[model samples]
Target: MKSLLVVSIVFVLIIIQGTTIGGTRFPTSDENSNEEYTYVEYEEEESSEESTLPPIPTTTSRVILSTELETEGPTIANEFECPTNCKCNKKITLVDCSHQNLMQIPKNLPQSTVYLNLSHNSLKTLNVNDLINCGELRQLYLNNNEIGKIVNTEDFAKLPNLHHIDLSTNAFKPLQGKEFSKARGLLTLILTDNKDIVTSNVPIIQTEKLKTLYLANCSINQLPENIFQNLSSLVALNLDNNPLNLTQGVSAFKPLTELRRLFIPTVPRHIALNLCKNLQVIDIINLSLENHDISCFLLFNNATYEESTIRTDLFKTPTDPPSNSSIVVSTTAPTLSTHIQKGTEVLKQYANAAANQAKTTYEKMSMMYMILSGLVVVLLVAILSVFCIIGSRQLGREISYRKQNYRKYSAGNVTVENPNYERYLIECEKRQFTNE
Candidate 1:
């Protein structure tokens, strides 16, 4: 009877240990601690949920945990559905599957996932069939992967609410707009630092609603006739590390009437960016025309002090997009409040741009003054030299006139018709007649 009682006590302890914290703390499991997030655990996961370590999947069940969160009070980890192999926060609907060396998309992702990060992984192919589970996905990060190209454009149709895709540092180049043709609400696309974009076609991006684009160091050397035909509403453009020249009578930049901040590497002497109203010198001048020196955006922005009309769009970051009606997306999204601070930064950038512009104007004016002073000095010297020559000629002529007058006076004044001897004889005869 005593043995039976002890066995029951031990079984009860085991059960108790599985359900309670037991006065032990496990580390938090989020890699991106850059922002605040509510932590959660899988219903099936019990002990590992308290650990921040990346959980290894078991044969029976994958045990993912987002445990022991800070900054937010109390964890409702039991309320969320999560896999054992990744971190999940159901309150914000964030699933971070990054740095897991995932060969393929995980099948057990929470249905409510909104922000899915599969970056820094070994994903080779992105098949759209796997994305049917997260129909409400908004921000998809597939950067630093082996995805050569999107398999099917139609598959992206499943994620209608998707926007803010990052395909940087991937082999998914030579893009036609069809790759994201179905992502109608797409706002931002980052395709920077692609090695295989040497032959990227002109007008690579055809997305009209695109606001921010990062194409730095993409080997873009030239523009087509209608390269920027579609992006009328583009805001910020980073064309750094390119070799483009737009002097070929191509209005590649005219279409970007709504364009605002244009980041480039340098402004060559002949480079002109009249559309850019401000100028600030930075490393790695992004070229778009004529040896990649100057273009329209650089010229216009650096020279003018106009307040950015794009401020509303630049400062106003959208709030969490509503989840699609068909699916409950992840809720872990950036607080729109952060954009308020970013808006302030925009003001600061304008101030800095203004200061830079003023400094540039001062330098130019100083240079011009120096040039004009030199020209004036040169002109003054030439005028003085001519005056000196005239003065010398006048002095010589005056001296010659005085010398002739002195000679004529020394020989006694005589009329031109009267000879010197005749004047002397006439004077002598006049004296003799007077004496007689």
Candidate 2:
């Protein structure tokens, strides 16, 4: 009976231990004399099977710990946490963190980000070293920022894949020395609206792939003779709103063979035409043409004979009598009036004859063009027919020869015959001397 009671007690203890903390033993404090408290250490046996079980979720612990941290929320200037009320769709790979009153870049950003927009921010300076981990970042917009100067050119050179950049409206006064040489794949650059940025001595000549460049409103007074000599692939350039006065003989833009757009405002139409000879469009608003020749309008009202300096000797003279003969010819007034009327009718007949001549000339030119077009079509057809006939004859001869050769080889049982065989073949025979 005692043994049965002992087995029951052991089974109850096993069930109690297994019921709490995944079978981990609970420690009891020892209350001995003068001692405040002491924990009873119990070394629980680690089951190999227990280790195979799925890990317990620690989310509850994390939530309890976070509650204890007493974090209110993200503040305006805080760079660690996302701003409150900002909808951050976790699925988007490019975050528009621009114009958000962010004094610094947010920390712990997702590593999958390939584009980051920090433009129109209060960031005074950017440490490019911080972005070395973002190797996949291809585009970065830093325009309208308070960036004063570039500290290290090598910082941006490390981003090998960065292609497009917009650093306009910054305080980069005078760019210097291979600043963009590292961005080998950079195709477009916009540095416009930086009023104090005078000279761009950046070694952009090494960036052969650069195509579009915008340097408008940079306070540039003039462009160097070889300013664009290295950008062979440049297609568009915006130099508008500058104080540049290009000289008449200055061919500084001759090297830009692929340049399509050259923006220069307030330039004379004639000068614009000459400066951009290959240009398809020119935007010359508010042009001042004070000394432009106005002789073209003067000849608009001049007679054709006077314009061409033609002789008037062949033109018909008026048959009307002189004014002084009116008084003396009063006795013959009826006869004089009849002569005047006849002269007026003769002039009208001459005008009608000239109009008919002009109409005939127009019809003749139209008929000539029609005849020429027909002749050209006929000539082209004849040439095409001749080539077709020659090609057909050559093809027929080749087909016949191929068939004859194919039959001979097939009959000898040396080669297999194919119904669709259309290729040429050559056979060689060995020379041997027979001895009798």
By lDDT, who's the top model here?
1
Model 2 clashing residue pairs (backbone):
none
- Largest TM-score belongs to which candidate? 1
User: With candidate 1 superimposed using the best TM-score fit, by how many Å does residue 28's alpha carbon deviate from the native?
Assistant: 30
What's the TM-score of each model vs. the native? 0.46, 0.43
User: Model 2: runs farther than 4 Å from truth?
Assistant: 1-88, 107-109, 200-206, 248-250, 277-436
Roughly what TM-score does model 2 have, to 2 decimal places?
A: 0.43
lDDT string, candidate 1, 293-328, tens digits: 222321333422112111111221256233123422
lDDT string for model 2 (51-105, tens) is: 2211222111100111112222343222334334222223333445665767666
Lowest summed-lDDT stretch of 10 residues in model 2? Answer: 58-67
- In candidate 2, position 148 carries an lDDT of 68
